[model samples]
Target chain A: MPRSIPDQSKFAPGLTLQLDADQLHAFFPLLQKGVAVPATVGCTLKCLLCDQFSIPADYVTDRITTIFMDNRPVDDLEHTIIQDGSRVTLSAAMPGLVGATMRRGGFYAALRQGISHVSGGAAAADQHGTVRIKLFNLLLAELGPLVLARGLILEPAELADLLKSIPDRPLDSSPGTSRVLLTVRFNE
Target chain B: MDKIARIDMGAAGGPKVTVGDLGEYAGLGGRAMTSLVVAAEVHPLAHPLGAENKLVISPGMLSGTTGSMTGRLSVGCKSPLTGTIKESNAGGQAAQVLARLGYAAVILEGKPEGDDLYKIVINKDGIQVIVDNSLKLMDNYPLVAKLRQEYGDKAAYMSIGSAGERKLLAASIACTDPELRPTRHCGRGGVGAVMGAKRVKAIILDDAGMKMRPPKDPDAYRDANRKFVEGLRKHPVTGEGLPAYGTNVLTNVLNEAGGYPTNNFKSGQFADSAKLSGETQAALEISRGGSATHGCHRGCVIQCSGIYNDKDGNYVTKQPEYETVWSHGGHCGISNLDTVAKLDYIDDNIGVDTIEMGVTIGVAMDAGLAEFGDDAAAIRLMEEVAKGTPLGRVLGSGAAITGKVFGVERVPVVKDQALPAYDPRAIQGIGVTYATTTQGADHTAGYAIATNILKVGGDVDPLKTEGQIELSRNLQIATAAIDSTGMCLFIAFAIMDQPETFQALLDMLGSFHGITMTGDDVVALGKKVLSAERDFNARAGFTKHHDRLPRFFYNEPIAPHNQTFLMKDEELDEVFNW
Candidate 1:
């Protein structure tokens, strides 16, 4: 057996995976626009926020207006790190004063001078892990379908946990009742 | 062509009513009309709750027309809470009905000599002011319910509840929505207290046998309206996102941006945020046999409001907006959506500003009156307001007063009004707005959130101070003009992004009045409105210092990002210089 899906060894005391940025985005195109992909893509991982993905240069130059990692908006993309079980979001230019204030490396970053995220906590050197991504507004429509169809990887336990949160009555035959459709294609 | 109706409650031998020409106020409507009247007539230094402070209720310029999203009503008076000129607005049937009844503004002047509550009924015929002490101290829901029986379901109502009756600073005036439920409110700066001072229990607008106000050129008006609706329908924010999840959709987006203002502005993130998010709430609402999308008013195209039913499939309240969710949910460290919904119902029914009440409760929690994340304790505090207990009265005085009473120093307010959901430290452009808006700490006053978060019109770096002052100034001016038109402010999303849609608005105005109006004219109108309001606030003893965020916003750094309000006082002073 392929170490029983979740594979206890995969989450053992000392395991690290240098998650490739291209492989991450290729497997989950929804990550391009930004969506909280759950932590099913296993292994305790560490990667620089800028190195986690290879987006079009234009995305950095003009397309992406804001970037948020682990709920806090990333003001400095290069210095910021994406740790295990983190949520990374990407967005095009958003309107309003707050939108500008949250834009990465934008002119108004001084307004939120006290609250801009600092790169203090590094990713755990060796541990088991999971991460989530969430896309919003325009990005949702721009990149949602592919993620739903191809589906990002999730640890079996995390998948089961998410499933339990859904009300039991709607889990039967009609997938339409659920906002997110999860299909179990294979079992270890 | 609309007439002004003035009611003098202080008149000897009962109340006296007079109908007159608009005269100098002829061209103004909505916030423009109300702000002008209050600024020109009322003494700036007069006690806001005294007879000297006049209350002006007016419909926007396009209120009765067939234009979509153009039925906002402006309620203006010197605010007892902020001690500044205040023009609070809301959407309901009242504006449309009152406008069609041929009234430009209804001025409630003077104060009632005795303690008797009065009711004013308006229809196609005329206006009637009558004494009805029976309606005294009744909450908005039951009071409107009683009126529905007498006035029938078609009439719209504006009323106050125990909070207003008690003259609390946080009191809000409730306006009945399409379902005749008193859910929509003019909830800011204690305008309801001014109405209470007038001893007016409710204002019923029948408008039966009246027709919609016809435009000067019907064909042109129809064309402009069609284009306006088209722009609204195609915009992602207005059409799809708002309709699908309502304004609460910002819950997840703002949370993800790390500016959600959880636990009384201590941090920008909430651990249990997903529980109260728009996504979760919408799903739950649908599963519980309620709609995930609905409109508060008939002509609303955005449909950002909805009916939230409890698990048993009974209506609790209209879908709580994002601010209400953050205020009652994350601000107080409570994440139970059902609890937040119930709190919303209580706030609406008792006629209190939900934002003020939520922030006050958070301040109380900081004082150890109740533990953070304690839902039952929050409910008890709301019940206290409903019951008009001593503790409730202090709480109902709003967040600033609550902070004083409880000795909690970290109060988030500007000019005495509590800040809305967005933290100024996290979003600096809004910080500039909060510090400078004439109406105090109001989000909708400028709504830089459009550019900062939604990317509707354009993008601004939300975290930086660069371009923030200009952004706030331009938005404030545009917003003042929009408020005067009586159009829903949400239309800004489409109009700001699409120049043609903006032109369509000007065309609608031109077609309605049989005159051409340019972009300059719109800017001029906005400037005119702001000048009137600024003049009033100045006369009311508000100086440049009054236009600033709480000092704690500068000293205390919120967690996660650890930011403080960095906008200088001098930069904020420049917001209204134009």
Candidate 2:
């Protein structure tokens, strides 16, 4: 049986911020730089994105045109498994030769045959672990709000600059914590 | 689009202008018109800056029509930089304006005596040649501003800056965008030097009263155009990715793929690439009161261009492109967007090719003239080019000369022209293109193909890597065909993926020209253009041996991939076989 991801907020002391739509969009830099999210490792990329992250499979198929796992271009989402400490980057279809070359199962995939992701089989058992997720370009606008609402973990240093900009916002994280669980609520 | 204008700068008692019908070259446009004219008229062995060499300026076949994305203008000549037949095109109002002025092409021949500068003005009435000595040595920004005072905002302008006046080998000819800013450039092969050698500083085109070129079947043309636009809008790359962040969006993806050359091609990845990524650049532009989506011309729907502003919300320059960002940012080990934007402005102001200038600076850094990440030093070097200093002259001659003078062994160039941002070692496919393209190391040389029409990769085995040769050949041929249409190459992304889009393009062309155009016709046109270019190069003493990357690319391995260019010279020679 697969293990479920824990409710990080229940045990881990963190901060909850209420922001307007603009501030939520401004928070996308954290995603571009990268943020950590806990998930069940050893699952297929489709399961990891759809089952765990709650991103609809149709949206994943349609919107996510480019994907890179640990800097290797990912072609087959079903066979490529998610491992612990994997750094995943998602983007919409990019322009130019290199952009086309990086698309998921694109015709130009032969152009970048050296760095393509050859799937290693899924792990013997599923285990809870952390993976870094990065969103770029159009994906930032599409998936950013959902990922922020679900929650993410950020380094204290990474949040320093953003925290300074939004001083009046509420903070509940303990001082000197190494990492903070951040959840954003958009005011309707 | 019916007649050709010939101006002889060497004619006795000042310059002479003659208008003639396109007798031998009747139905050609864009690259086809330019390449065919240069191949037929100019002597291959003649000095690039001499009287026997001619510069042909032409608009693409669909340029002045109501067709979408047809604003490309081609300028061809014997290259002063590469010593090869060259055709460099750019997007601006020049093509549409020139086409509406009823000129298929403008041929500039013979070199002027003495150092007198001249400007050519054309409107609905006629063409005029006036000696404009005051315009000498002015940069593109101020030169366009000054010209706008008299010509007003209703005309499209083409001019050269100090770099061209000095005949620097990396000089480019600037074309005015819709905003009348001289930001779009026909950059590469030192076409501006050929213009400067003719002593023509600028050309002004006014189509104030001229009507758009009429199509043979207006209803069919309009229907095809609507479907073509829908295809472009529906595609993810053309609709979302490009318009959102522009071409700089490629920086992150290329870096992730370990193909973004850094520190003079020593490595494939840069540590600070995130700082210069398109996401950050677009957000910064928005935060600073500038736009992240803009067009270079009136009919450009892709809107891959943008405006760059300083931290204080003041206009700095147009958004630096992916090549500009890579060449100046990671290639030289500098990672700041502001610095890259500043270098872009200076390069445009001096009317030099950004790819050539940035690569030259990187080679200079490798030669120990300055530290790799020294942003201030890079700006100073560009300023030197503007001032025409001795060191600047050497640098302005391009990477090949810069490497020779500095004794650097690993200069990244082919056929005496600097390579663009993509490192061929990591991406072996582009390496084949860089090695075999007639235009010398240009990335766009094999781009904009309708792959469905060409049936690319169908015959070649997917397991064998030699499929790249077939892919490159078909792309280059189809690219030549598309370049003749004056269509923006971005449309290729939509057309390559959607068959309906490709059919729509054919329908648009067929209806406009009153012919039943097909895929075979496109392929034939592309082959004709490339054959003329190759024939001219062969006559100029180039052999199959010239179709190769620099020796260092094959000898030295780059990091991340730890791969060298694996394609053999024999395999590269197969690219032009078709």
Candidate 3:
């Protein structure tokens, strides 16, 4: 277990799940777009995160049992917000693997590019989602409908299923599409 | 009330009957008795808008008396939206005022004969059928203003708008809040249509001084109420989080948890979801010179509602909930907050259920009434409905009509009512509630909190349905019991965290009745309420099959996560095992 991950399963039994830092680092490359990566990073941007059935392997420690039965024990779950000016470093392998992977295509991919560029979360390594509501809502208002009109006939109920399969933002390939849905304004 | 008077309406031959022959204040409160009376009075298959469909208003046990947060009321009828028994509760001085005037329940039956409008006024002496020809109000905003002018400012008023007047299936009953603002509505289940059928534009209340406080061991009840409020104020969910963010806070959180439904439930997350979320809403309120937190009723400690204004500094409406945001924004692929805000604006003025309106509009877009994300076009379509155009007639009728007109196979609904914001494929427990609830796909019907953890129970992996049924059943029972007390639903958070406060409610009952009560009795009453509702739905031709998630939920997989609704039929049946 990594030093940072806390075991929270003491109260909830059968809640343990985990991802080694090495595996986490392997996953980090898939989130960054335009960064070329080794062929080992896979083709078509179809990593486990975007797959339908894969759940995050992080386990919640059973708080009740952990207190009584075992004590090599994962310490407290230390939650900290990632702030600017904090030093961030990636493993030596991330640079090459991320740089070589094939890029993701379509609207989401382009939107993520703008999001990363604006939030500047991309520079440090894994910038999943920056807190940018207005930017996101406006772009979605514009692009999402166009995508749907182009024939992604998705029903409302299907969203939760989609979310489970694809955990990260899609990479944008179309240069002028603006990629994000929220930026578009309603034409008066 | 010591007076215990009755309103005759002074005019004749309306559907008038009486109850409370069981003859005790302790027997049944507002929400419970209303459900039973509706079941007993209206034919199971009667059209919801017909004269035969009765509307009942009953006060909580403590409303007319001195008690903290006791200014609550219930509006009950066979819902035009759900096509079943529905009791939507609200907090206003109306119920307290009405109760003090001496009536346990007010049942408005049959239609009044006229194009001419009227109003019903209740006071310490009796009921008066008043001539409202002078008012002839069309809009709710101006109608409340006229009502305040006629009756004093302190009077509690219950009125409906054009949507209710037209008998729209999704119409809501508008009741005044503590601020004397007509913002806090019994905002679901077509209660307004029921009131409108009686030809009553508004019911003006003026009960001067007839207090019928529960004759509990006074010290004990007071002690219990204090503890209850204190517990509510201490919890972050009820105390701080809700008041600060309002219900819209869930926009970002639910999205992060993979529970927020987007683009007609196609994706769990909306990238720009944060923009329309509670954070942005709170920020907007600050910038626009509006209050971020506002009280719904008198003496409410957990003030989780807000009044949001527009850019022009005009009062737009309450910062509509996260459910409203998700329903209009992501469901139809329209993320423009301003456009979404327009829908909230129309819904409040129109006096209809926002959930029903959004889903219906989305369905209209699905059927080629408008292009997806053509928010302007969508607005035009709704305006057509508002103007009573032919297509507007169908859309205004509700989700079922829209689904029928469009031939859309992926209708996200249960029992004719559209499902609310939460994507059940991710939050399976809420899905069970949507499927089984008599109110038809409602989230509030079953919302029990987690036992110890700050995080709630039923946080099942979105993709798995393993524990959804069991979790939903337990929650429904808890919720029904709470609703019977006429207490605010937000109080559930405090009760979940503190056993003492929860117990004190039961203790208050014991104090009032002069008999010892147990936790088991509360459990029994909850079961009874559910059984009564089940009986109503069954009689109304609602087979167990109707209590189901839409078929597309299983066949299609949502993108991004790619999860399907995997709960089996037999597993869903287990929801009624309790």
Candidate 4:
């Protein structure tokens, strides 16, 4: 809940994303928003930072301090596998001992030997689908706006429920929101 | 500026007070001052609750100054909880006020020889040890309110509650914050038990006539203080994230890393972590007419603490930290934020350590005293502690005693102190600290999380055993030094990442004292403090075998990642070698 946010659609100012029930179902997985990331299950489990996703070179070092795949700390990102449906998470630097202990390929990796992810078996066939992504702490402020503008895969019911919870609070009233511009694009 | 106040509670005629020069304790402050006093003056093998065990209270080196985030007070004693020398520090107005009154430390020696409780008052006028039996068994909130009415709200207060009066091992010393709310606490290892043993209900400090301690070099000190404040403001952790979300922000981050220590350490991940997370808690506080960002003391620039209001938009308690949330919420399988907040208020009011109390409840649940996730049952247990019932006494003795009383074998403890929010099996560097720290399983002793997860100092692989000893060692030393300075520990994030910030802290001290200080001097001070603590523990019969996690941490593999504590005994033994 600390880092949960609806992905905003990018567009001109004063514009909002309004979609019909049928249209909402056709475009995105709105019902599973925040509850689950209904990404493609798995044809194969690939190494996270290797060939699974094309992450920028500096993203691991500069962007993300903590990484998690399938609720397990991905301290060694190059070795940790990301299956199709794996819930992947990224966050900027955090406080306390757990934060230091979870860094990817960090010097203290030896401390977590029993829990370190170890990849096994050959790579699976290439496929296109979805994977759960969560941003937290400083990463939410740094990349949230950009990710929101790019549009997020969400379940419509979750969004509706969120809006109903606090009718007075605007969707754009989070920590670092100067302006909120939204546009809904249908897949079909 | 160089005085120590000694109170002899068991004096032949009656309680008496003596003021003397600092002597051997000239340059010490905070943990260093307290630990050195306990280590030197008190007998190691004496019963912690007996007359021979003394309690030493002192402010940090930079306390009572113009420095940012430097209002922490340290309380040290032979801990009834851990049976080791303990130094617990907290942020409140007491440190600054106590220092301004021109005393380096207040040493309470010997035990009172009666059932009657007393109160001690100190001001510019003199010391007053009053036999006020009317203050018996009062809780922290009402006790402070009564004190405020009698002594005025301008005085800083430190007091005990029913839990402390009952001599419960989980009892904490309550220190009123700037707003005169008894929300800040020295909440570890039962320093309140020792205070209770001394038969003193409260120590009121009135510094109405005192001014801020003058600096030796005013201009240099001002420049250094400005640079230090600027450094904190520029850093992301201190300047933005903490101010926006407070310490509970760690709930989500730890949950994501699979090291959140849920269900009483049976699992690493909690299903309902988000409900008790910092973001949701912040929004709830804001919506309920409470603030999401506030300072515990006057000079705190980071403002990581906040105010939490209840459903009716009335003040309830300070924002619960991540450890409190995890201990009472995720670890017990309770997800309701309101429940956690209410629990926090109850703990603060009754002057109990929230972490110790919550963990005790979790252990009781494991023993079938109540079901896990039973929010009402948890609240009832805390209420019982407030009333000091027979069952409540056992519950208030902390997790180790509760686990033993209930025949629960999965007690997560080292040296009888409860392990905090982090699962050591998942984050092994913390395991090393928990196992080897002189103060038992305290997370703040050496917070490796900064490097392992936050990447502030340097990245350390949390899951591996290599470099763990060194990481815990360096952090323990650095943390000892910082705790001495009375600066908020959160500053380490910025200082570790930015070298100049670290220099600025040293420069502030140097400018204030009119001396040239180098990084080596800080390291030396840290080494001295740790050595004193280690020596105290050693004299108290602690051997290398005492420095170990419970057997279950090695035998049982936590879920999600299915990991066990992998550090070998030999490696753990080498932690304090340097």
Q: What is the C-alpha RMSD of each candidate to the true structure, in Å?
A: 6.8, 1.9, 13.7, 6.4
Question: Model 1, B31-78: lDDT tens per residue?
Answer: 999999999999999999998999999999999889999889999999
Relative to the true structure, how large is the alpha-carbon lDDT of every model? 0.77, 0.88, 0.59, 0.79
Model 3 lDDT per residue over B1-578, tens place: 33222232323654233333334333666677678778777888988877678787877656666555666787788888888898887776677777666566777776766666678877766677665766553657678888888787878888887778777777777777766666657777778877776677888888676556665587777776777777777765566667776777556445543556776676776766655776567767766877778777766777777777788777777777777887778778887777887888777666777888888887777778787788898789778767767787788877777888878776788888888887766545567678888788887787653222212233333223344555566667666766766677676656665777677666666765566766667666667778888898889888789888898888777644456676667877877775
- Candidate 2: TM of chain A? 0.89
Give the local distance difference test score of model 3: 0.59
lDDT of 4 by residue, B40-73 (tens): 9989998998999999999988888888989999
True contacts kept of each: 0.36, 0.51, 0.00, 0.64
| Number of the top lDDT candidate | 2
For candidate 1, the per-residue lDDT at B4 reads 98
What DockQ does model 1 achieve? 0.24
Give the range of the ten consecutive residues with the poorest summed lDDT in model 3 chain B.
B449-458
What is the per-residue lDDT of model 2 for residues B1-578, given as tens digits with 9 covering 90 to 100? 99999999999998999999999999999999999999998899989999999999999999999999999999999999999999999998999999999899999999889999999999998899999999999999999999999999999999999999999999999999999999999999999999999999999999989999999999999999999999999999899888989999888888877889999999999988888988889889988999899999998899998999999999999989999999989999999999999999999999999999999999999999999999999999988899999999999989999999999998999898998988888778888888888888899998846664567435544335777787788878889999999999889899988899999999999999999999888988989999999999999999999899988898988888788888888889998887
Better of 1 and 4 by DockQ: 4
lDDT, residue B360, candidate 2: 96
Work out the TM-score per prediction: 0.86, 0.97, 0.73, 0.88
Which stretches of model 4 miss by more than 4 angstroms? A1-63, A72-83, A104-126, A145-188, B448-464
Give the worst 10-residue stretch by lDDT in candidate 3 chain A.
A93-102
Ranking by DockQ: 2, 4, 1, 3
**Please, what are the lDDT tens digits per residue for candidate 4 over residues A124-188?**
55443446667776665454433433444433443454444433334552322223333343222
Given candidate 4, what's the lDDT at residue B522?
75
